[model samples]
Target: MMTNHICFIGGGNMAGSLISGLISNQYPTNKITVTDPDQQKLDQLKRQFSINTEIDNLKAVEASDVIVLAVKPQVLKVVCDNIKTATLKTKPLLISIAAGIRSTDIDRWLGGNNALVRCMPNTPALIQAGATGLFANTSTSDNQKNIADQILSSAGITLWVDNEAQLDAVTAVSGSGPAYFFLFLEAMQAAGKQLGLDESTAAKLAKQTALGAARMALEGDDDPTTLREKVTSKGGTTAAALASFENNNFNDIINQALTAARDRAIELADELGKD
Candidate 1:
């Protein structure tokens, strides 16, 4: 249970997901609060979760020990600036879910207070099946890091990186990874339909196959390459498919795509953090 009072700075989808996850896991509703400018959002969230709601950022920030900065990347600096004075007094552990904003920039925006954690969570978080990557500033205490981990782990699997730049790679791999898989699924479904199956059947086959393969990869002790080798007999159907993938340099294409995502992530930090 999250014993500490927690305040969310935004009442959007990501924030809603986290709150729902926490409530499902038996965290006290009374210990949580969410602040948003939108009255409709606050009403919906309050009705659904029964947590406290606030229109004033400073009042919300002052009342909580953990402040989740769940605002959009474009408005995160403004939110930080607005809460800087309150935070300087409260010293709440700030956890940011905004994309492409570095902890250093957040600290600087918050008047040099350094306790912050930057998190990247994918869309699957809504279903409590997310993969999140976190990077903490040097000023975060071990206990604070543990709290951050626990809070994020409520949503999905959590991974931590020592170097902040690794979060870029995390963004490329898991952050943008879901879309890559969806694209592959679309191609697979189309190919199945072309192979004389109906569209519904093709889609079911493609989606179930993807899900089963993922489960196998996660549950089995052996690595993915060995699992593939186990399934592929020489000159068999799987071998033919592998040959086609190799011929098209599928791995290189994936590398290029993820590299583009990581580069763009870094570029975004620069673009968003510029004076």
Candidate 2:
């Protein structure tokens, strides 16, 4: 049981997932409190997790050792402003999970107090199979960083970035990476359907094949290319597929797509951080 009290500002899906992870992993459910404007959401969280609930955001913050800002990116500044006074008084470790919003911007909105950590976690976090990239502001202490790590690790994997700028790369790779895989899977399913397989059969095959391949990639000592090469024999069906993809410049397209994702992430940061 952790002695720390953690409060989440928004009772959204991501926050609910984290809370669910924490309780299931025995992180002292009584020590957690969630505040949201939606009474239904708050009631659901409280009933599901047997933790505290509040509509008074500042009261929750003042009672907490950590404050997780899990609100939407567009409304984050207003949330920051509303909670600024409580933050200054309590000085809890602040962790923001809103994407594309920088820590400097959060710090500025919070009256220039540091002790901030910004996290970009993908949708897979809702299932506790997430990959998260975290960056801490200069004012955060080592202890607070550890707390952030502990909280997020309950949901999935956590990686720290030395410079916040590299988070844009992280955003492109893992944050947006799931959707890319989903697109590929969707293509495989569609192709299977086109080949006369029933929709259910095609979906099952595509999903399981993807899961198995991902497991192989993770569990095997070989790199992805080596594994791919191992499956791809000369003048075989795999060879035919590879040849087609190569002819279509698949690798170049993937590179270009990820580059575009990174660039767009930067653009979003600029757009959301504007006064």
Candidate 3:
């Protein structure tokens, strides 16, 4: 329902997912444009979403009110440089979804003093079940912030952070959070198989259990701790398993893992933000 002429700089999976989400929400297809180097990808997107597709980034920027920089972090500067003139001329809100690249670096790449929103969206966004963390630079207006939220929320839940530094914590939590769940699922499947279930059965049960647990946590009124306690009775199998996890110092291990992820996120930002 937003009237903004939104343009995406990449036509990859994440971009495609966002386009699909927006269109499904009744966002006007005519107001959307996507630009990418791959003609085949662009053609597929155009056919699938019925939106405008362009190989020329500048032309796309010319008529856009908001530009989603969906390109990879390594080449974001080049993409920004290519469209800087048109972006300055149009003064569109810039939303960068490239990981590790800071807002200051993106602002600088676009010739500075531009409204920019930096987001860290995980791979789950490809399925529209994403959790995205967004941070807006001081140059961004309140209206622009709302627009950015609208666009990103189409994929899944979106949370705003007051400071850009908190995005590193976001990067550690939800950004890398999916992989942690996937890893846990993998372990659960392996343990199930070790307990005599066939591979297919083990995998299916583990996946379905994860899905059910997630739904309960999301939909139920109780918090996760309360739900966990409710399910874990004394002398029960769940309690035994939880005891094993506690004996293994599971909480400390997870804290250490997230800390490492957060530290790496900070390192990546430092590396990517260099001029």
Candidate 4:
């Protein structure tokens, strides 16, 4: 349970999703505080949740026990600087969900004494099925990490990484993984359409097959490779398709794409650290 009042620095979709999930999971909605420059978002949040909402960042910073910086990467430094000025020695455990921003940069931006946790969560979180990867600075306490986990796991699964560098890989994998799956689904639907099926029927078949395959992989005892081999008989359609993929080096293509994404994530972190 979130015993401390958490203040969100932004009231966008991600922030709103976290807040809604937290409230739904038995955390006190009244203990949540939201701050946003946009009045329309603030108004909508206020109407949806019984929590406190404010336009002034300073007041929200002053009142929070745990401050979650839910703003974008571009505005993170500015928001951190404002919170630093407002709170000074009273620095709370700061949790940031901004992609590509390191905890060291967060600490430096806030004058280097604050406890900070940096995390990456995918878009599936909006549907309460997210998987988050968390990493914290040396200043963070065990209890603070637990709190952070609870807040995040309200939407889905949460895992901690020992090496901060692993977050870059995580950003490439699970953080951007959902989009890859979505893209695959789209392509499959298109392929189905090309095979003499109507768009709606093709979509239904594609989606259900994808979902069933995922469930089978997760629930069965066999490994993915083993399970795949079970359905792929010699000279069958599945075997033919698998052969085509192997011939085209699909595995290598996926590896290269993920590596490129990881490199980009690292580059973004470096850029954000440049002051």
- The 0-to-1 C-alpha lDDT of every candidate, in the order given, reads 0.93, 0.92, 0.93, 0.90
- Give all TM-scores, in the order shown: 0.98, 0.97, 0.98, 0.96
Write the residue-wise lDDT of candidate 4 on 1-275 in tens digits.
Answer: 65798999999888988988998888888889999999988999999987789998888888888999999999999998888976576778899998888999888888887888899999989989898999988889999999999999888889999999999999899999988888998998899899989999989988899889888987889889998999999999999999999999999989998999999999999998888
- In model 3, the runs with Cα more than 4 Å from the true position are none
How do the residues 20-139 of candidate 3 rate in per-residue lDDT, one tens digit apiece? 889888999999999999999999999999999999999999999999999989999899889999988888999999999999999998888999999998888888889999999999
TM-score of 3: 0.98
Encode model 1's per-residue lDDT on 1-275: one tens digit a residue: 44899999999999999999899989999999999999999999999999999999999998999999999999999998899999998898999999999999999999886689999999899899999999999899999999898888888999999999999999999999999999999999999999999999999999999999999999999899999999999999999999999999999999999999999999999998975
What is the alpha-carbon RMSD of candidate 3 to the true structure?
A: 0.9
Query: Deviation in angstroms for 8 in model 2?
Result: 0.2
lDDT of 2 by residue, 140-184 (tens): 998889999888887899999999999999999999999999999
Give the Å shift of residue 202 in candidate 4. 1.3
Inter-residue clash pairs, candidate 1: none
Q: Count backbone overlaps in model 1.
A: 0
CA displacement after TM-score superposition, residue 21 of candidate 4 (Å): 1.2
TM-score of 2: 0.97
Off by over 4 Å in 2: none
State model 3's lDDT.
0.93
